[model samples]
Target: MIIYTPPKPAESIPLIDLGPSFSEDLAARKAVAWEIHKTARDTGFFYIANHGVPQTLMDGQLDLAREFFDLPLEEKIKVDASRSSCTRGYETPGLQTLDDGSPPDLKEGFLIGVDLDDDHPYVKDGVPNCGANQWPEQPENFRTRYEAYVDEMFRVGRHLMGLIALSLELPEDYFAQGLKEPLFNSRLLKYGPQPVDAAFNQIGAGAHTDWGMITLLLQDDVGGLEVENAAGEWISAPPIPGTFIINLGEMVRLLTNGLYHANMHRVLNNHSGRNRYSVPTFFDPNYFYEVRCAPTCMPENGKPDYPATTVGGHIAEMYRKTYGLAA
Candidate 1:
């Protein structure tokens, strides 16, 4: 059973300055990688500053979310997620339950990914979560702005992956092959304050680990995100202006052979009174990329705890479990 717990101030989640990671100096980049290595080993969660995404773009994305969510229900539902084969549209509150045995999440969201046409090979072959996005018509320039934001995210995500390779003592381009044609799903989520008589364990988003390799999250100032520490205590990850929260995911754990872990986190907007907004981009390798234990992560004498899996396969299973869809 899931228990709702109030979180304490965070003491272990580190705030990492990513400026050095973008430096031309190899030593400077390696220094940043070392810091990431330590944090990933201990907490699997951190905040990144100097990430290079323009302030205007970030603010505009948030403004777009507010504008879209403010649309009338009738208009928003016109592109309902259920209507899309790839789940690239709006989802109503309670549509997903992130934590097993807990009440459904108190959040509504819009999901989108790399836009593809009906004739695209991936779409024609019915790749899970791969196809054109169902865009809303009311929000002017919504698609144009969001597409630009996604491009910037892709840039950051790829750069971080390079750092991660270095952190594992491998060449910077170790994951380059897999990333050649990457896949990502960006979600714009809004959480209203939980009701006074809400069900037990009900919250904005349930306690759960992310499904992909890494998650880059932009959260509004009215913070409610909480991450579970190694000791199982919940600590608040309050919003730090100009920084984005970065968290490892299950796939990363698999790659590192448990040398790193995916920490559990949840959201509770109770104290904020007003609605909370966040945008999380789930960055991953190409759908068919084989995820296996990295050479540096191999145990001295034992095999990897997890078996190798394909990126798309693992994500498909996770989606099925969370959305209660048939296998």
Candidate 2:
């Protein structure tokens, strides 16, 4: 059975200042990378400040989420995720069960990815989660604003990936090939206040590890997110203004041959009468990019613990498991 200890205040989760990373000096960039390397090895989760994304853009995205979720259910469901082949629209609460054997998550969500046309090669070939998005007619400037935020997120994601490579003592552009035309799934999630009579193990989001290489999460002030430390204690990851909570995913664990961790996290919006909102962008490599252990991460015997897998294949498997979708 799954058990959740009440979260204590965050003490070990580091807040990294990324300003140095954006500097032209190689030594400054490497200094930031070194901090990331230590954090990745220990927690696999950290908060990044001065990430270069504008505060206005960040606030606008959160405001948009509130506006979108405030719409009448019928209107919100107009562009239901069920209507899209690639699951690129609104999903009602209880639609996804992130933790196996637990009740479905208590959060509503909207998902979108690179806006591709039907004629695009990836769409034509039926690449999983790759296709046009199901946009809502209501929220007048939803598309334009959301897309703008997505563009900035892509930029930050790429830059962070470059730093990740440097963390592994590789060239900054080591993952350039995989990053070209990368695949990403950006999700806007809303969680209502925790119900008084909630079921066992029920929460806003379930205890689970992300499926991609990295996730950049922007959360509002109604703190509820929690991370499980190496000691199995639950630690609160409260919102820090102008910062995004960054976490490594299963793929990173594979890439580092288990030297780095892919920590388990979950959310519980227990605020008295308020809702919680968060946007997490699952930034990953190209769909077909092969994933394997980095040379520096290989074991003494020259054998990796995990087998090679493609980005698309791994994500597809995760979707099937969590969403119970057919292959």
Candidate 3:
């Protein structure tokens, strides 16, 4: 059956008051969590206000990200992604993509996973980011600030995950088990508008969903991001002041047995003369964690599309496709 598509702006963006509601009242928290559920199931992405993150810190992170992006190519390459199996270094614009059989994405990213030692459980046995970050010694404060921000993002991300668990009526800290030493990633992304004369120009980032459970995004005002809704309409997600855009990802869909969704999204770059920067925190469960159809997700009448599966095994299959991991 054909579905009626909603217009782009039809997506509802609820500004949650995180101060008293999220902290004090049980019903308040559930109400906020339900909002997340509705938005995730209906559209897959939403902007959050009153999220409690400081605008000053957000600005500080953006300035640092842009500064890194503006550095000379050679300097930035000191931590190139090719050096690691996880693709955790600087990506030149057009090096990666998720478009439907299209060319690579036209954006650069500096990727990092959770900070941990060599013995972290998530990093063991053919997983990425089991070691310390490769820092650029030339920029003295770069490592310091970058690490701090990523850490904060991880803390906040896990907190939100707990709320999601509560909304689902699962264990309050369902994410805690897999996240004891979570395999989270924070990317400093830059979107540069291309020159008209340039021969092979394209959009900033191709349509794709996060591989992790969820993504917390911070973007400057110049917006180009869009997500597809249940009605198959593409909704533009513009940048809002002091707010973070949250998106459901593959892992969450898997964990919830499709109760949540991993939405399709893309970035378009007009010939407008502007540069945009965004930072996103990607919270992935431990590489080996089994992501499956929760028992609570099934019922007497309806069975699952697939059998219960481990999170690690599923992610491994995806890695094989993306990074050529051994079967």
Candidate 4:
């Protein structure tokens, strides 16, 4: 296994530009990869600028999300996540507890994945997280804007997969094969201000590491997201206009044999009486794809920490733990 080295001190998160050139020129792409590699090894979190996602698209998503979350409790419950065949519906506050033994998170969420019908090949084959999406009828333009945003994020996610492969010193397209028919999960989250008394244990979200390969997040100007540095100090990852926050997840850390840090992070509810909104798209490979240590990540004269496991199983177990469905 690769050894872990603690960061010397906390520093402001870096903002990198991932423009069209990143995917256009091979040499430049590798240079970019080296930069990402260093950042991943240190913090696994960075802000990406010039990502090509339109400002209007981002605005549309946030607008639609606010509209959905503002609906009456009864209206929101109509699409409750508990009703989904696959986790593709609305989740009320306190439904997820990311930090084991701590109070549940004080945020509401709406999760959507690769939208597929019952007749789709994957769904027909009984693959998990490949069912139809739950829709809200009140917002006339929600479906259109939401789907458009998801499609764009999916494109960016796929592009980042190649960059990550290059960063790991593997063939740039090494992850391409695995991502064929990949499972992409996106969540729209709303964190409202909580009273000081209720905020003791009811954090906006609890400290935890993400379970997927990578996550691309879009957050509004109202800041609250925090990431723990190697030195154990929590640092702010506030909103950066025209950029998306990207972070490596547990799957990547495991695949890299711990060379990369999948740092712990948590969110705080706004106390200014305003709400915080974020959209996080989880880019994961096909459910059945087995991940193992990459060649460059194997420790000298040693083996990987563990054998390969299906990405789906690893993610599902974490889901169970967070949702209190684990036995």
lDDT, model 2, position 294: 96
Q: What tens digits encode model 4's per-residue C-alpha lDDT throughout 1-327? A: 979986476477888778743567798888877878888887789999998899999988888889999899889888898888776789998999999889999999999887888898878987655589998786787778788998888788888888889998899889887787787788999999876778456799999999989999999999899998767788999898989999989999889998888999999998889999999999889888989998888888768886788888888788778887741
**Global local distance difference test of model 4:** 0.86
Candidate 1 vs. true structure, TM-score: 0.95
Every candidate's lDDT:
0.90, 0.92, 0.73, 0.86
Q: TM-scores of all models?
A: 0.95, 0.95, 0.87, 0.93
By descending TM-score, how would the candidates be arranged? 2, 1, 4, 3
Sorting all predicted structures by lDDT, with the top scorer first, yields: 2, 1, 4, 3
Error of 3 at 312 (Å): 4.2
Q: What are the C-alpha RMSDs, in order, of all predicted structures?
A: 5.1, 4.9, 3.7, 3.5
* Candidate achieving higher TM-score, 3 or 4: 4
What ranges in model 2 sit over 4 Å off? 1-10
Instruction: Give the 10-residue window scoring lowest on summed lDDT in candidate 2.
Output: 4-13
Error of 2 at 217 (Å): 0.4
The prediction achieving the highest lDDT against the true structure is 2
Runs of candidate 3 with Cα error greater than 4 angstroms are 1-9, 116-124, 195-201, 319-327
- Model 2: per-residue Cα lDDT over 32-138, one tens digit each: 99999988977799999999999999999999999999999999999999998888899999999999999999999999987899999988988787788988987
